[model samples]
Target: MTAVEEKLQLPRIYKQTVKMALYDLCIVGAGMMGSAAARHASEKSGVKVCLIGPQEPKIREIVSGNEVFGTHYDEGRIMRATATSPLWADLAKRSEERYRELENLSGVQFYHEIGALTVGTRYGQFIGRTKSSLKGGPKGYDNVEILAAKELNDKFPYLTFADNDEGIMEKSRAGYINPRKMVMAQIVVAVNQGCDVIRDIVLNIEKLQGVYKLTTERGKIIWTKKVLLATNAFTGMHQLLKNPVSYKAMPQTVTLAAVSENTAKRLSQMPVVLYEGKGGESWSKTYPRDSSDNIQFYLLPPIKYPDGKYYIKIGHSDDILKGSLELTDIRKWYSGKGDEELEEELFKLLDTIFHGVRFENHHGDACATMVTPGKQPYIDLLSPTLAVALGGNGYAAKSSDEIGRIAADLILTSKWTYDIPKENFKVKFHVPSKL
Candidate 1:
């Protein structure tokens, strides 16, 4: 047998005890970080990893001749940048390769190589800095470039901005990941590697002498000698940290609508655009989505001008977005009623690009932004048995898999082999008075 077969046939960590099964590592939340870590750890190394999430990632539909998850529709957080730590950067590069390998191994196409652009009306815009980071360099990343307004328009005729506008361009090194499909693909890889993934919500983790007892909502018990808290966005596992990484979960809502194929074609012809509007107006959550049956997705500016650089738009709770901040669900994105002024502004936004349309505001009303007060990712050994990972507000999709891999390395080997400072991984926030 070949080395690959030999590895595959090799038995996993757990022999299945009567009271609780054992795993090399038990991960919570099967989203971007957790799923990638499980898949990468299982395939690249012999780590027997287990992932448990509230929902199972559906993969067969996207591949294997069945559209189970629907017509390749996927929209989620954007992954950008090359990575700050060498360990992370290299892992990110490998993850891109791994994404292809996953296609080769599973016969599914989950990634698009379209380069991303971050348009800034002025300096101090961190998204532009993030685009430059993905370019990869010492003076700055070589893969990234600063595009003058003229060059920007020439490269992407669909995009227009103020004459003084500056943009950060990463040539093909960055692109959006179909977040939902990406999650499914990674979990598929993990399960194929002899790892067991059960669908259940982890309610609590109790330290038992040297081991951890994990209780699930299904009443199933799982025991692991080690645990990795890979849950991001919103899962209160931060309390489990001996050195709990800190990230503020700023709930946000995005207004999504689908236009005709013509509109999509026009927008698709344009490179992914992020216009930080002039007059202090800014658009943080908008992108030309070319990968789904859901038409296009966008987050319009709250006001004609963003009085501040970045601000979270908020509103009352609803079904999917109970704590929604989306203006599309109730307020009109086109001209209408009490919000006519805001509606007209958004209509002009579309008029600048496409024609003809239908709209569906599919996602839940509430979306969450995992913000790090210091603007960085937090990776650390929270305890001897617990490891924590979060805060990818910058470009998590481009970085999470690799970050997750480093996190696994740190957890399994007991040290941060990379050169990133201790402060880079831990947050020193003031303890709350009335918790």
Candidate 2:
């Protein structure tokens, strides 16, 4: 034992091991946008990046502990970038490519090809408008196919359609992506690529002499040469951005219910389905169940919201978010109370699809923020070292990498040029009644 122990001593150091200093860039809020931005910023600019967010913090901690619930957290259902703009199509395709590449990069499964179907009445004006307005090929929307009701029903026999109904059936070019897993994958990639992902909540930002200093809730001050504020829904992140209006920050509540696969089967065959029908609200979307076999609840996108009466959220224009609402402060939407009447509306929708499912499996609710200040997202510069790229609302997932690309380019080149054609920020709802 003595001889073996003596031979197993620590190796002598040949040279001093140097510790690197603080990063060149710091990304606040490690949700989808932040994580994705951090990865690209580091890779493109070759600058060390520091990612700050709560990762499974103790339950009482103020940051992510109350929000991000470890691997149990998720970003609901995702759609392939199907916008009628070439800029949107290119951005979406890039996001989709990265999602697929993450599997090999992180050895974690991050995408599912459940696919999507947009349904509406054949003779309905909404359907006709969708086909026509989406025509003449917006930059990124040239490859999409438009289908009539019979063809849609034939391919997806699981769904019922009226005779005069029409459909758009897309293939691998579009499908379902697991938002949470994709986020985790980006986090892992950033870590492996030599980015520092710190576990802390940023309290404030102070600029001294052109360098950015970030103060954390724990009272630690970190300095970085450049800063990218990628907080998705955290209110604090919005205020930090040079331009608040560009964030157009708003909060929306959504529901996630667990119904047996048998029930999901009878509703819609595809993973993601949207209702743009004449008078129909986006009722339901079904993704193949997660590892837990629970389908996700995407609920409302940005255009979907309560009347915005006050601090807390209320009302929904559609059935999907309405019926399956889980009551909790996942995103801190409250005045210290649960809106039972709102819960009842959500229950009505859940009851329609999942007739007898028990609420025992109803995981507590969660929330995230949307930033679509304008029709086209602006990646502009208010200062030399500071840049802002936000306002996608819930649609950020489709264009996040490009968002990061533009943000990073602006910071590195001191130029505010858009990598993707910016959608015009109309200050109007992006969708009718919201998806």
Candidate 3:
């Protein structure tokens, strides 16, 4: 191992009771996708499986150390079946169909199926493309209602939108999922199906004669017939693969504005909103291409947080700021507040959208998301004994259950069983010269 790897390595604890136990498959991440894959793999294949990943740190201070973090630590992630891509829309529709089933089976509640609204310029191609993608896609776009600015403003009086912008409201199978609770639900379901959960960070993976060896930070070793890498933003770390996969881990900031109970009640009918409109010069920079005309802001209604306060949260679309590919930089990035100027910009954006709503208090936090070349996840097998199902590209949270199901099916059956073409998710490897 290199000197940098040694500095982050955990001291090996030689367990006196150590025994080289074998598993049919071992998953290297226990986040949304990994946990869902574990549930599917164990329930469908009846194979001995192990899900390994460290639990989320109880406080933000722990991120100062060499710790792994998850973007699903938040209370809400947008859930919708309509998208610009047919594949994503299909994946989301499949996953949304199982929300009730998963909830009843695990006896956990994570989905709040209120509704979802997306507004964009009438002249832009986004609204038309989304509608077209949904016509022959999943759910047939019947539940989506197209409304002009007048009808939209009359329906959602609290929201302020430009006259030129139109809206699409998904009446069903769309809303927000509490990601933290969603992971818990998956873990519960997976555990009920006889999958072991290992709460430790994966330090290394090595291939043996017929199985792969997994080394945890605390020195626990597991042998499995196959391995699935769902490590997301941390995939390049730990040198699990011979060649690193091509992906970007971009820094993001979300601002949460606390609202009073009365204000929350007034906005109770608010649907998860995605608005594409103009951008300000200070925060919006043309990166990779001209994005000034394509700036998007996603908003989640007032949801109660762990602090017992109700707050509305908002985040900017990707490619607005530069990001890093270094493990050390990504780790350090999570230790502090994200772009302060961006946070202020979000505050103003929320005020402008919400009209007369007054926020009690607001704060910004740091997060990172993984993006792939095609903006779709890579659910492919690296080798006969090793597979990978990662790279959410920001759209995987709502579609995670379906993605996991596809991955589990691939790894267990060694077949591309999904209706979508396998070529759409082929993994590509390219190490970037600079972050």
Candidate 4:
């Protein structure tokens, strides 16, 4: 017999078609939230969880190509306890506690305990509201310090603060995290706990005989007792239900700049800084001239990239170019170079804040943040078997672990069980469009 024929005939069992797989819970979109849900469901809920999503690109360089990129595929994300609302702050605190346990279990170091600073005008309403929400002393925060402008400048001399600006610093459990690594670590732990991870795009979801059937791009099928749509930007892209969930995808851009080794070292001890813009001011009027304005900007600490050069990432709260985007529009934007005007603005902002720190190579990428009309995540059951955990409002990354746990709990028990108020995360149907 020929070698090929002999090999083919060697094991008839090996050539047999595999049986269809069934999962207790099937999660789509294995990004930050979905991966954590898979891990929590498999480990804590003891369910047969299967996670489905495309593999992260090996090369994330800002190149021209036809590839869909994720917002969380970055070196670092700012994790802080200072939020506009107390519920959000509590969510961040809860997720911070879980970060330690996840690191120990997965043996992956992702969270950095450096610290975080939220700076605004001394009398700004933003700062006042944040401080008020964080009341109850240490019960609400860990070693929180409200620093005056002079005090902030004294501690972080490299940063430029307006004379009237003040900062709120959380001394513990606040800093940045390697979002890409954190997602991978969650998947690692989930797989170790008997969760199946699939690298495929889900095309459609349908219900047949009271079971959720997920159809993948590769023509594979999966049946699950419950389905969780943790997909962020691509939340309503698929026809997952008879009546699709509604969400608005707000496209945003982030710029990354590679600084000199000396500058990186100088900024090594600087905490994550959020330059809270004044309520209604322009960047040109607020930044170089004064640090108080309505142009919100945030900075992540120096993190080493694949090229061995440390780059500090900066993102604006308001998009330089604003509009609602669909999944295809977001993918097309990601396939091309980022916005030049936005990149230039970010570089200028960085230079102003860091006192003329020259950035060597600057590049940027496009990502979309989903938001409901109410500006909170919608975690509710679409049907008896289909549950969705969509809408981050561009501030959900730091609290994704708890959000994911909430998603899983909603799927397993068909109810919201987290300590957070159900109204904060409850899904609102038939809401008028904010666009």
Best by TM-score: 3
Ranking by TM-score: 3, 4, 2, 1
For model 2, the superposed segments whose C-alpha errors exceed 4 Å read 1-22, 44-46, 56-72, 84-87, 123-145, 235-238, 241-243, 246-249, 261-269, 279-331, 334-368, 417-435
Residue 416 lDDT, candidate 4, scale 0-100: 63
lDDT value, candidate 1, whole model: 0.51
State the C-alpha lDDT per candidate.
0.51, 0.51, 0.81, 0.75
**Best of the candidates, lDDT:** 3
TM-score of decoy 2: 0.69
lDDT of 4: 0.75
What is the Cα-based lDDT of residue 49 in candidate 4? 83
lDDT digits (tens) for residues 70-144 of candidate 3: 879899999997788888888998999998898887777889988999888886777777777776542455788
Q: What is the lDDT of residue 298 in candidate 2?
A: 30
lDDT per residue (tens digit) for residues 343-413 in model 1: 33344444443323333222223234455666667677766667766665534665667777777777777
In terms of TM-score, how similar is model 4 to the real structure?
0.88
